[model samples]
Target: AQSVTQPDIHITVSEGASLELRCNYSYGATPYLFWYVQSPGQGLQLLLKYFSGDTLVQGIKGFEAEFKRSQSSFNLRKPSVHWSDAAEYFCAVGHGSGNTGKLIFGQGTTLQVKP
Candidate 1:
């Protein structure tokens, strides 16, 4: 079965510090990976995605991720952390062809920023 894992349940960082959120996936074939952020009581917002081609992808809000096929990982990173960036981050994998836009998401990583 296809699945996504976010080992860290929570992370804390000071403002201006660098941040990294880990994500791993298990699938039989190449997977479409995505990173989304959700604020309290709000819908998810796409941060970045990797459908194909380049291994390194840039996203909104100064975020970036690299797709590693060998490790089956697509980790999200930010060079500088902002208080507004504090939210719940999720890593999801698409069901591939034949499926709608449904995605299997990881448990989620909660990011806390200190001023």
Candidate 2:
């Protein structure tokens, strides 16, 4: 079965610090990976995605992620953290091609920033 795992439930970082959120997935074939952010009481917004081609992908809000096929991981990273970046981050995998756009998401990682 395809699944996603976010080991860290919460992360705290000071403003201007670098941040990294881990994500791992298990699937039988090449998977479409994605990262999304959800502010408190808000809907999820796409942060980044990996479909094919380059292993490193850049995203909005100064975010980037690298797809590692060997490790089955797609970790999200930010060089500098800001208070506004504090939100719940989710890593997800899309179902194989030819199917509806259904995604299996990780538990989620909450990010907290201190000023």
lDDT of 1 at 36: 99
Q: What C-alpha lDDT values do all the predictions have?
A: 0.96, 0.96
Candidate 2 lDDT (Cα, whole model)? Answer: 0.96
Report the alpha-carbon TM-score of model 1 versus the true structure.
0.96
TM-score of each: 0.96, 0.96
Candidate 2 residue pairs in clash (backbone atoms < 3 Å): none
Which portions of model 2 show Cα errors greater than 4 Å? Answer: none
**lDDT tens per residue, model 2, 18-52:** 99999999988789999999999999999999999
How many residue pairs of model 1 clash at the backbone? 0
Tell me how candidate 1 scores on lDDT.
Answer: 0.96
